[model samples]
Target: MDNLQLIKSQQSKYDEIIEYLKQDNSYWLDNDIWNVEDKVFGEVEYKISAKNIRFDFIKNEVLKNEVKFYLVYSLKNKYLRLSKVLNEHQFAIKYVVEYVSKCLLNKTSFNEIHIDNNKWKLFLINNGISLNKNNQIHNTTYRGICSEISSFIRDFYDDREETEKDIWYSKNIKGAKIPATGVHGVNGHINFMSIPIYYRNTVKKYFKNIITKKSWNHCHQIISHLNYFFTKFYSNGYTDGFIENLLRNDIENYLYWLGNDYKDKNPTYRCKFVSYVRTFLEYIQMAQYDKAPKKEVSFLIFQDDIPKRELNKDEVKKVKFVPEPILKQLDNNIMDLDRPQYIPIYILLRETGWRGTDILNLRYDNCLDPIWNNKEQKYNYYLCGEITKTGIAELKIPIRDKVAEMVQKSIDKAKDLSTEENNPKKYLFNTYEGKLKGKPLNKQSLLNTIKRLIEQKDIRDVNDELYHFRLHSLRHTRAKEYVEQGMGISIIQQILGHQSLQMTVHYATVTENTLYEKWKNTENLDLFRVNTETSRLEQVDLNSDDGENLIRYEYVKKNLDAVRVPFGVCFKPSKLPCKQQMNHCLTCASFCTTVENIPEYEEEIDHVKKQIEVSERCGRELWAEKNKAYLRLLKATLERVREQKIVHKNGKSREEV
Candidate 1:
């Protein structure tokens, strides 16, 4: 059946179940059973409805099972149909049906269901609802269902006042479709509702407006602080009265308490508490009090009183690209994958820098066939998806033939599996088996799979340091490769689907070692001369009288700032530093160059002479003069290094060797 019709059908079936369950003055599953002789005497009959067909098990004496046995048999077909329409809740339905059936059978008759109402509620609370094929129930909660069943039992079976409305602890607030009762939802909100009526209403309104997970968490934290406030100071009286006497000092004192009492807590937490509390006060002041600035009625404004902490430095540093060697290992292992299911995903991530979320949720319909590109002169394929973090929709990743081929193969695999009953046809990548079978492979699942394949035992960095293998590292690795290939920041930003250039800039971390290497090759004179066999070290006897001047010259050379430039180093002391600090270093009195560096200078002089000749031939006399002047400086430096011989500390000139 189509989805809408199927939904209607399932709802109808649930209505039937609830109707049958609530029949008679007492509800359907009440604990009151007739004797087995009732059926023989035609006093009691067991019947169930499915697909508009009624099946009576009481007449069929061949099946002498109890209430549970007949109930399961009667409803099993209906449950299967319901399960197909509702995949996520299939386990819950199956569990409830089977559980109720078992409870009925154990008592020997249908009337015993009334006696087991409390037991059933306890069962719902403890076992929580379901056992699905995918084991999703364990990752889920039944707090809402528990509260519902508890209320129902109390109102119908027991003799309790039903005046109180259900004050929900878990709900899908802030337009969230699914109820967030997981770790993100446990933000002390239920406790917050126990505060003064005025405070409770305000807090509940704020919580309902908080749409993001982060906002909800922050609200939860603020509620926790309010809890502490109610418990510590106004435990005996209504907190609303305390608000009248509240002063600026009280708020400051609370912040101070948070700082001192939770001294061991992370400083960031303290800062967040101050921030959230301040926002809460502001929210109350405007939302309820009409933006009045009265100290008595208003939440005391103390901007300085709020705790502040700087963001961690390590967290700020970005662009931690994976090393090439490690990436090579990853590629080798990934290509050798026997499953081939994960290969396309890894390659897409490694090559295209797409976030794991986008890749995991990739749809078959979003991919397009390879099209010819005049610029690239080759066919390129595209995969379109939405960026969940930024909400950038229809973001397309242009793929080369190799990556396209892998994706096409995966698409074919998905299509082949989609023909099977209940197999997913929408998601391109899905697990065919296991608890998560037929479901799109989640980010964590893909991460675990990749980690298992690559890191057999332990993942390590390029330096052999222990490293955590993350899927994000693949994106970073791709970013680094793009930067190294001279791709512009804007181009990289487009490729990575970054809305801001600032984010793209963070991924351009060129390591200090890489910077130093580039400097050595292009700018450092020491490296330039060293490459020409220039000997920076010379022999000298420490005991000789001449060695003192040698030592002084060596000290002068080591301390010079000329190592960074291309013209050569200067031998000068800071006590009597060179007057020429710029390009004039070549003509300075203390300028120095090794004999081995003479060839490079000579080659440069020859190139300049040719340039001068060409400039004169082209009738550019000014350009010729400029080249000639540069040649003169070069020739002078060469002549000085070649002929000059310094006298020793003893005043004896060295031999011309």
Candidate 2:
């Protein structure tokens, strides 16, 4: 074979081996590895990923010599085996040097290393490395190249093992003395002697049980809490006891110590620690073959000990919802993001008012419909997904034409690249690039991207506080807008996928600002004066005017609807059965009257007085007795209307209203 054919064969072989290494479950710490590198003596840099490798030497004498002998002894056998594949003539020349100079520098990745049928062979020949076919030193140079790459991989793994504190290392690394600090310790690691060797097996079993349902990241947290709880228990003069032998008081004391030591730590952290210990205890109980004494594990004892987040009555009134103008601007800003993948994500959260987790986990078949109709050539897009948090899947939200097109485009893109099981689509939003590229984008990745942009754009809460825009804020803004539009709480409850109306009310309901603003606008101090003398004022006669007089009734009714109070609407529908009838809503939260509606209230009072006069003038004593109650209620309703109107217009104390 020619020199170029030999080089091409070698390149293909190396590429296959690298691909094998990537697919091998045991070759690397993580099968899915990213770029990792190490610089030796600040001159020669070595970088490697699953698919690519890079070696950059400054060409200085010291560094060149260091690279030449880096790991030659260990790699000599491997290099010799690789060289044996080449023809006798090929082996006589410097094959490794030619490969590195011609292939490595020219190709960005191993897969890209192919004979381009260019001037690479001629260039290698002109470089003037002993081209005499009798040369034996060429083998040594091949071995040197292998040594440098192997040494780089080894150093990378060594650095990762040193930096990464995998929980398994604690249980698996036997006779390799446990460090001074435990798995979670900062200085070194906790000494193995501190935890009784007799109980180590049991502890491992218990840790395994705890981690069975948790993610690797959450498992680390559980491990840390367990480590701290055990260390604390042992330090408190209880080293002789096993985990099961510990009493409730012992556990409580450890928690009390946690409280005292971590006084400044938030309750969520403390609560998590307590929860881990409780789960450990429960596991211990279950492991005892049904004869273990049942121990009551309760958070009630530590309720007061653990700090909680509580809002005052007044504080609860003012919920933090994104203002309309800012949300509109945020929508525009999100659309203008550099990455188009995140645009659909933010818009989905903003428009559908669903949690990010629900949106992230949205699937293809059930949650989305790619094509709405065939004959009409129009789309009837909808969001139909289960809420991850609540497990409620009643979503059937209609999508806007523009948003539907965006989603369809993203779906098409993902489908073109997808190789998921039996379907070209998996996640609605997949990672664009990174170690996780083409996989479903995780919640943290989206959060970090959004937070970075928010900081860059200086997007803030309209209240001027340091209101960090969280992904969930979009959900809140949507809810607030719906409530302001007078949508029913029940409708919103379903939209948010909340199992309970109470949760909907607490999480997505409008704040008191809307009510406060309405009240502020209607304030008039003069309304506070009770003008009893105004009874002598002339009243308009409806019967004496033309049919245009009915406009006054419509005007009064309209104003009644406009005024909203804390109790109920001032006007009661005629069909509703109420003993009080027209005055039923008086003094209720929904009852409201503006200064503009005072005349309406006054007209009702006059009408009621006229009824009483007619009953007495007709000598119908029994009818007059019934009509007196109506007069009294009308007077009471009139007085309330005047008082509320006065308070609303004058900015009087809410207590007075």
Candidate 2 lDDT at 462 equals: 57
TM-score of model 1 relative to the true fold?
A: 0.47
Tell me the TM-score of each prediction against the true structure.
Answer: 0.47, 0.46
Q: Quickly count the clashes in candidate 2.
A: 22
RMSD of each: 17.0, 20.5
Best by lDDT: 1
> Per-residue alpha-carbon lDDT of model 2 for 1-657, expressed as tens digits?
697975676555544444433432422212222122322112212331232122232223222222222222122212222122222212322343345455567533322333331344334455553434543223334323333333333332232342222224333334232211112211122222223455555555665554334433355566577778777877777754445355657766876898888877666557777776666666666677232225544522344544454445555665556666667667677766665577788888878888787787666546666556787788777877755345443477777778777777777776775665433336667654543444466666577777767666777775665346667777888888777656788988888888788777776565567667546434421223344788543433445553245545444423322212222223444345555443355535555556776676677666555554544433345444544665576566667657765533334556466
Q: Counting only residues 3 or more apart in sequence or on different chains, how many pairs clash (N, Cα, C under 3 Å) in candidate 1?
A: 11
The regions of model 2 sitting more than 4 angstroms off are: 1-221, 240-242, 279-294, 298-321, 369-382, 386-409, 420-425, 432-434, 441-469, 482-506, 509-512, 518-527, 530-657
Q: What is residue 79's positional error in candidate 1, in angstroms?
A: 22
Number of the predicted model whose TM-score against the real structure is largest: 1
